[model samples]
Target: MKIYIITERARTITLEVADSTEIMHIKLQIMINEGTPIELQKIVFNEEELEENRTLKSYNIVNESTLYLFRLERQVGEADMTDERKVFETFENL
Candidate 1:
């Protein structure tokens, strides 16, 4: 079955899993990109939040079912143009 992994990290919903892998690591890594505090306890897919002890096998999830790492945080602030320019300039000089 075809399943989708809709991630909520930085709006980066990726479909990277094609086999048995620890999705928790991927979820955590993507969330870090947001550069903010994250509470894994509240992570969920659709309306059914995942539990700390729940593994992929718990749901009999196979190649058919899709997994998503959804982050439940609203992004704040906008990109400071000045900061971006400065960073770009620094990289250009190196």
Candidate 2:
């Protein structure tokens, strides 16, 4: 079956996958195709978060189903000064 995936950034892609494919596999494919880390991916279907242990068929997802992708929020305490500086520097270059 084919599924439509929409990223938080509004990027869209259609992919063909088996109904038996696990949510984790889809997450991995997103990471590979969109460069979003699998650990940071949160997929929503029918307004419910898809479970890693569950298959698309289990969620009743079928052809042409649209899944929303969101990035997991980073914890405040997990922020690093170096990462912030890098982000600023990259924007400055732009």
Candidate 3:
């Protein structure tokens, strides 16, 4: 099935995935496509946050379903500063 991922920055990404695909896998795809960290990705459907361990089927997500992606902001010490900068740069480019 195809799903639409809409970022908070108003960017859109279309992806093909299986019904059994876990939310974590979707986050990974976003990571690969947008350079966003999987840990920082939050997927929401029907105004509810999707659990990483759950499958799309568990949420009854169908073809052409739209999911919102949000980047979580946190202070992860000095080691995470570069990653945070990258995420911001990605959105800035869009």
RMSD of 3: 6.5
Q: Each prediction's TM-score against the native?
A: 0.39, 0.80, 0.81
Model 3: pairs clashing at backbone N, Cα or C within 3 Å: none
lDDT of 2 at 41: 88
Candidate 2, superposed: residue stretches over 4 Å from native:
76-94
- The reply for model 3, stretches above 4 Å from the true place, is 76-78, 81-94
lDDT of 3 by residue, 12-83 (tens): 999999999999999999999999888778899999999999999999999999999999985557347677
**lDDT at residue 46 of model 3 (Cα atoms):** 100
For each candidate, what is the lDDT?
0.51, 0.91, 0.93
Question: Which of candidates 1 and 3 is the stronger one according to TM-score?
Answer: 3
RMSD of each: 8.3, 3.8, 6.5
Model 3 residue-pair collision total: 0
lDDT of 2: 0.91
